[model samples]
Target: MNHGHDLNRRDFLKISSLFLAGSAAISSQVGQALSSTNTAFAKDDREEVVHSFCEHCFWRCGIAAHVRNGKIYKITGSEHHPLSNGKLCPRGTGGIGQIYDPDRLAHPIIRERKGGKSSLRKASWDEAITYTAEKLYQIKEKYGPEAIAMLHHGYGYTFFKEMFKAFGVNKFAKPSYDFCCGPRLQGYTMTYGHGTGTPEGIDMMNSKYLLFFGTHYGENMHNTAVQEISEGIRRGLKIVVFDPRFSTLAGKAEKWLPIKPGTDIAMMQALMNVLISEELYDKKFVAENTVGFDELWAEIQHMTPEKAATITDIPADEIREIARTFASYAPAAAVHPGRRTQWYADGTQRVRAIAILNALTGNYKMPGGVVKYEKFKLPKPEAHPHPHFKKDVWSKYPFFVQTKPENSITSHEVVQQTLEKEVRAWFVYGVNVPETITLGRKTAIEAMQKLDFMVAVDTLPMEVTGYADIVLPECTYLERYDDLDGGRPYRTPFVSLRQPVVEPMFDSKPGNEIARMMAEKLELHGVFEDSVETYLDKRLNKVGSSLEEVKKTGVLVGEPTNLYRKPGEKLTFKTPSGKIELASAQLKSAGFDAVPKYIKHPEPPQGYYRILTGRKPMLTFGRTANNRFLNELPTARENEIWVNPRIAQKHALSHGEYVHLKNQAGIVSEFPIKVKVTERIREDSVYMVHGYGHYYKKLKWAYKKGASHNQLISKADIDQSTGAVGFQNNFVTFIKEA
Candidate 1:
């Protein structure tokens, strides 16, 4: 539809064709049932659905495929799904590429040397499993169970962690715990009591005011929030976006504040001062619901308008005006808790500051705000507690738990660094580490190099797979049945399962098959049968359904509760406070500043502009770099830096100028750059789209097209109380190469 400001008159014809194609596809894909009944099938195609959950990105959306004989024809969002509403993102629709990727490992390959670069060769399933398990056993016997580590990415890999624990390996990690969202969870649980992975859900459509700090839900590629936010925009909600870059969502926002990266805390505190000084804050809610106000007030008193002005580049008057707006809107005004918090060392504190604003505004547990959601109930095969490991490899690492006796290890802190000393081998399940690791690619590479044994379970040849002793090619989500985790709660109440849409295109196997094989090899067949179909059936029975039922319905949905509101009654948080916290009492005791504070980020030197990393909606972090549909989506090519024309002229840099961007890391990449001088962005910083300049020659569309910001990042981390890396915190000099 509406192209809005992104429209160009001459480009209209091309846009029309693209829009029509996309719309027609969406229409057919969304209403697959209707289209299926009308189509005539040739004997060349016998369509059958293999139910599965999507692993395209982390959302794990459920799907039931339409297959013809042995080949999958297409994949659509499960109509019976409670969460997705039968809608899939572009990535989900592009499932075919992953299934039929040409470079997919045909069979397991063992590197000739123990510590060596991996090359593909024929490997029998038996030999691969036996050799890998034997090596793990050897490492356990020699260096102790702590010597072996497992780093998992998606929630599905929790099963592998279970396998590790069953095998007496306790040194396991998932990026979600430490590097991605750990600090924010720590901040929230330390303050309020529970942390949600995304916010159970954001009530954007009904909210009056929507405020964001570092979150960009629209471009973040989580479709649930993006879809809802779009609805909110249609309803004309007061949407305010606060981030350094002018993102797609920010461009659509009523107000966009292009602040300096990492200066959020100062602005938030300034707003708090305004709220309290003018009595705009909800006094009743604060008095009755919160504790430690005196301490918080004491700090806010000193973090005055003048001091906040100096700390945050935002002028004092603007901060006061925004604070008035925040409190003025009150109750239903929601602050979005975004995905990653491990960007800056101070990330936890930053999110805490944002949460504090929520408390002051009395938005907690209210409709049209951050509602306290009731957990969804589903029947699943019972999973008991993990068995005691030989030793706790994560014993040295400290993690913040929401409840009593809670202890979980931080992924960023000690889990990774201690890999060589405390851990001998690693089992990587469904995670791409090289691209995900911040500023530690070399260190990660070295650690992976030292491993006695390792295995990477994925579809394509990811960067981490290069070092794997065994690379098990996994079937795409379209090909196998997964556990109920995909539609576990938010998506649907009925346990949706993934089945085969086609016999795997290559010699690839589903992750479950690999798991089952490992289980049998380790003689844990009784406790853990690694068959995904068997597990799918087991979970199906719990939901009062079976594999046959899943095949018929595609997905199962519970009765819609009028709205996806907290439902029936308010849900209790997993945090110790029993409510939301602004200033955490638990954090105060943990040797970290209890209150979220403003700390000036390590600035990039003058002349060297800081480059912030972001992605287009069509692609994900280096995942869809191969999708031809998306590859040709016409992104800003070259290392196109968004520079204000004033600065461009001052530097004698014209539009599409070739330039050299050098950071403190001594890394440089060329740019056939387009100079975007616009009011939407800041002149001090240059911005470029991520996933460009794909170094891998195999990735035809993306390879060598532009520069990778990740390559240029200096190895400094933020004060990760916030659990994130401020890659935008680095400074660099940009020169017109002429």
Candidate 2:
């Protein structure tokens, strides 16, 4: 829903009062009411509108920030943007809450060890930057540039990435790669010869049948994907969901199969077996456009529906019927490659099976199936001179995507190297290290303690900042001009800008300025030779556009390219064999299974259940956890552990009862979690929203609000081929209040 509608003065004041009631540190000017209705505002009241992109989550939807009297009043979706399509998520509207949060990092600080007690003291930006640069240089001199690494998350990390590259620190890791998108990316790249684009190339609006295995669209709240799914539903799209918990998307599905957790590969193999044995697969497509069909069939030939039913708990007859129905839809059906798919050690293979299933149906580039989305082709500006980055591959995984300069290794690998004394210093940008699932909170802290130096750049005093040798407070997205976003792939190719909506509030600076300062401190020249505006304009001018024109609309749109494959067109993939590899030779060469094999994961012990994690629709984990506006809703207040009624009965737990969870490794949850005894989940598993239970006292709103899902991850099952950390192997048991 749009948040840009007109509001009367009384309504605006009421909202402002309620918003400011939570914290005293919020600026009084920020509490000033701005009535969108012309009748409610005085004729002299100054008003301005700034169009930019959002940083609430990775989708980066276009936002129109409403500024009245030099203070941001509201944010709404830009109609010109393809991702948002004039509709914004709740997190986008809550951007004000983040900017006005009381606990935001107001200034730069440096950790000092005085009288043998470590404490964070306020420091000037110069002092903080110089100190951080000197320490990083010292580490580089002693341990070499390979010793320094950067663990980043948000879109603001582009500048710091360049700064690190200039300093000869090529080691970089994005934690989301390790825990969320790594397996899916590597799996699809291996099978299809290209990674799945951001707005995943799903032709949802034209689809007749869509299959989802734990991909909850509604709860994830990716604006464009959710909007397309709604449109697809209106056009008679049928959905089949296989998940342990009945998610928001499951509620919209025609069928919700509560498949056993960690048994997705078995179910997929059964589907393949049904298709091949019954001659339901597209024979023409398999022969003309795919490779390794015989090898794939041989692998799945014995994984019959009856065999999978025993492993997945779905009836054999039901599996066959679903497979037949899916096949009946032909090119109009697809098994969606879900996000955050790193569940078991075989996650890459599980997704590979999904790719094979899609290929078997000839849905590779079909209108109603998987299509390739394109990014806006923006020419890169000339680079500044620097030493060639060290080409050392840190991850031992043979199939790791080492060509990607942004994230060459997994964050867990960085942690391992840090513990091994190979890595000496760290630059953490936007990511909350302990809360983000790298190797778990304990191991993350251990690596942090072991580091010779650590610098954290953030908008708030998150858990990561508490451990930093130097903390540089970055302004919120509302007060920043980040690099142009031409990387997001979409149906209508476009580049979005991130111009400032308001002036920087406190002593905080934008990431671009922070990185530039760090570069100057390190004696790096010509890297940031031009202002951010000049640099942006130069890049935009190459494409016959300017910063002034893009800033007005927030995005520069391009003609929509054809997504679907034409009839009888030969599809040439970028694989080694130049076709879709059903049985990947690259994987085989690396000693991995050429065809996906259903390997049984470890089961929970007696009285324990598998811990499943997801996010709420209104919030985006740590990004919006402390947002007062977003957190005001009852559902957004905190995370609840979803337990099946039978399991609750067995544990003598009641709905709304507070209890702590103890994991298989004997690690207890730091805070108590509310039990939600419902039949919406499987009896063998429990569900909780990720990104909560903040132990950092500075995060007043998010502190100890819910149990931390990452904390219970005492064991990480690493995908050997991709290095994606799988935490679903860890199980938890209830610890009822005494």
For model 1, how does the per-residue alpha-carbon lDDT over 1-738 read when each residue is reduced to its tens digit? Answer: 110112111110111111111334433332443334433221244555555667667776656566663445687877666546577777777776556555454556555533433234557778888988898888878987767667676545655655666677666656555545666666666656656444344567778788787576656577667777777778777888887777777877777877777777777777788888888988977776676677777777777767777766666776777777777677778777777655566777777776777878766667566554433456435543336554333434244444331123444433355453666676887666555556545445555655567788776666666667776766666655555653233422444555556444345676667776776677664546445657667766765777667666666666533333343455444445665556666677766776776677776666666776666666776557666655555662334667766777777777766676667666565333445565555767777766555544444455566655655665657453333445566665565566
CA lDDT, every model vs. true structure? 0.61, 0.84
Evaluated with lDDT, which candidate comes out highest? Answer: 2
Candidate 2 scores a C-alpha RMSD against the true structure in Å of: 7.1
- Candidate 2 lDDT tens digits, 1-738: 111112221111111122122356455434332322333222235777788999988899998888775577788998888888888999998999998887777778877775656656778888988899899999888888888989888999988888877888888899888767888888898888887778888799989999999998989889888999999999999999999899999999999999999999999999999999999999998999889999998999999999999999999998998999999997999999988888878888998999999989988888789999888999876765357666666778887782354577889999999889999888999888888945788778777877778888888778777777887889899888999999767889999999888766667899999889889999888788468989899999999999888888999988896898778888888889899999888889878899999998999999899999998888887789888788888998889999999999998999999999999888888898999999999999999999988877666779889899888888989999989889898899998987
**Which ranges in model 2 have alpha carbons more than 4 Å from their true place?**
1-25, 28-44
Task: Pull out the clashing pairs in model 2.
Answer: none
Off by over 4 Å in 1: 1-43, 46-52, 68-70, 114-120, 379-397, 400-408, 411-420, 486-494, 559-579, 636-639, 657-660, 670-679, 718-726, 735-738
Model 2, global lDDT: 0.84
Lowest lDDT sum, 10 consecutive residues, model 1, at: 10-19
